[model samples]
Target: MDAHPGTEIVIDRDAGPAGKLAMSIRADRAFALGDFRIDGKLAGLHGQAWRLDATTDETTLSSSDLPAIRQLSRADATRQR
Candidate 1:
């Protein structure tokens, strides 16, 4: 989060399996969990930026790349080479 500051993250365990990871990037003018707002242009959709949801069997690693990920835990072997 060095590049972007004031990022808000929320993990809703009660939402779905393995829960939902919601990450809102920092905006020039944005609000998270806001009740209501009326503006012409909200800052990058005004706080609702990205969502990272992990399912029970979802993964970015291919079968061949599993070895590297098993070691690094979050490594993308395909991009390293």
Candidate 2:
């Protein structure tokens, strides 16, 4: 997804398409995604990492959860406030 101008959009090449869309930011991550469809995957809350299906509804992640996410998915945590 194309980030808003002047926004930090982290593209994880190793993550492939999902990696490219995956980011390191926690605060207000929802605002960054303005009604976008993630083909083959439904965006879920933090910690779950790679599992989003019909059962999934909504997901939100915060700064406190960043460390584990970073470990699970490699990316620069430049979005942390």
Candidate 3:
């Protein structure tokens, strides 16, 4: 998934629980905002340390509820002030 111009995600279907999913972030910047949903549930990543210079380089996230996700979509969370 291409989150932005310099940020992308690559999923490894076989790396997590039986039906769970795992992914790594490929980003050019030190931080990013990940916003999306899984199985109609909230699964967003924000305000996290995403150092591209670390030994691991990529940031990984896994969730059991992710396995049941059949679609990924984004919603505007902005509201009237």
Candidate 4:
């Protein structure tokens, strides 16, 4: 999905039955559950790793692995390299 300039994208995944893994992405980097926003650009995504700025963060993510996100990730990677 194409996000607006300042749109907030929330990635949520059910952790077993009673818990969840959530991440909010806005601006550049993808934020974890702590609400920390990283500055720069979202490089791409591979498996469950979110490449932001020049660093890669790995987690048990869901949205990043979705078909739409995967397509975006491929585009991002192509542009970067």
In candidate 4, what are the lDDT values of residues 1-81, reduced to their tens digit?
434454465656653354545343544434433332233334344434443432444223334334545454354455568
Instruction: Sort the predicted structures by lDDT, highest score first.
Output: 3, 4, 2, 1
lDDT by residue for model 3 over 38-66, one digit each (tens)?
34444444323222334565544333344
Q: List TM-scores for all candidates, in order.
A: 0.23, 0.23, 0.37, 0.26
* Candidate 3 local distance difference test against the native: 0.44
Q: Which residue pairs of candidate 4 clash?
A: none
TM-score of 4: 0.26
Cα lDDT of model 1 by residue, 1-81, tens digit: 122343333323334354443222223334342221123111212212333233433311122222221333223334346
Residue 16 displacement in candidate 2 (angstroms): 22
How accurate locally, in lDDT, is each candidate? 0.28, 0.36, 0.44, 0.43
Please give, for residues 1-81, the per-residue lDDT of candidate 2 as tens digits: 434433343334445433343444322323533332233222334445533222233343322233433443333233233
lDDT (Cα, 0-100) at 22 in candidate 4: 39
The window of 10 residues in a row where model 1 has the poorest summed lDDT is 35-44
Clashes within 3 Å, all models in order: 0, 0, 0, 0
Error of 2 at 1 (Å): 1.9
